[model samples]
Target: MIVRCLEIIHPDGDYPVAEFDGIRVGGVYPVLEMVTDDDHCYIRVLGPDSPDPGLEWDPVSFETVDTRIPPGWTLAIAGGRTRLADARWQRPGFWTDYYRGDPQARADYDHVKSELLAAAPPREN
Candidate 1:
């Protein structure tokens, strides 16, 4: 999904930080993942650095540009079976690289990616 930032809110603190790094108002971003709790929803998008999914931001700060869910996406409970947060939407292979030491995780990631891609529409030239 794509979103356009509508505002930037800087949290008050004495930690020497002002605003979210690499994020600016009116900036458009592609959402890599989304999570919601009982009160609010958040999204993670690629930052100015590209490739790297930046920090999560409250959904209220942005407006949805594209609501289409890309292929290889799924909704699962965040924090696994321990925490009871709302389900999260994530892209396939999102957790693959995070678990480099776990063979099972890698296999699961590959399987999900393959299955989703096979069922997705062909790319337009």
Candidate 2:
């Protein structure tokens, strides 16, 4: 997914951070994934200098530019072997080792993975 920054609201309390990291108003960013809690949604996107699992930002600050799911992505429920805070849209292989030693969970994961692949759109040559 892609998003464009709509605004930058500064932190109010005595928070350690005082800036929006690398996020800028009007700047477009590629979202790695989105997570939600009881009341708010957070998007994970790369900062100007952060690598890999990037920083999570409030979804209210950005506008959705695209909602297309990338190839090889799958939804992971937060349970069993998964350590996610909530259900997540994640890249393939994100479940590695999480199901280890649990036959039923592993089987369930394999089944879901197969179904996801089968439902994916065909790749262009």
Candidate 3:
């Protein structure tokens, strides 16, 4: 499975770092290959089942990381069907890459992580 890096510029200047299974891609919010050159930074409302199961079709906005490759910067991007826009999973805190484990998967669904978690059914005491 190919994992794409999502370039997100947090409005508060806190960028979403690129991570796969909790492994940093050398830098915070690094450019990923799965992101096509044609892709531009904008907010898109994803549909239901777009990200994962149990996630309702609630509109989630995101900033696409449009990176211009530097003259001497070389990076490896794992290829997969995943995209920045598709990053919005059906459930908050749900990761598309299940193989990576819970922490990593949840890390991928950063956009609505808080929302999803909050939306989740309260734990039983």
Off by over 4 Å in 3: 1-34, 37-45, 51-99, 107-125
**Prediction 3 TM-score vs. true:** 0.19
Number of the top TM-score candidate: 1
- TM-score, ranked from best to worst: 1, 2, 3
* Candidate 3 per-residue C-alpha lDDT over 10-121 given as tens digits, one digit per residue, 9 for 90 to 100: 3445656443222223322222222233433222222222243222111122223333432222332234323343333423334436445666565655534344333433
| Global local distance difference test of model 1 | 0.55
Name the 10 consecutive residues with the lowest summed lDDT in model 2.
80-89
Instruction: Using TM-score as the measure, name the better of candidate 2 and candidate 3.
Output: 2
lDDT-based ranking, best first? 1, 2, 3
Residue runs of model 1 more than 4 Å from their true location after superposition: 12-19, 78-125
Q: Could you tell me which residue pairs clash in candidate 3? A: 2-79, 2-80, 51-89, 52-90, 55-90, 55-91
Evaluation by lDDT, superior candidate among 1 and 2: 1
For candidate 3, what is the lDDT?
Answer: 0.32
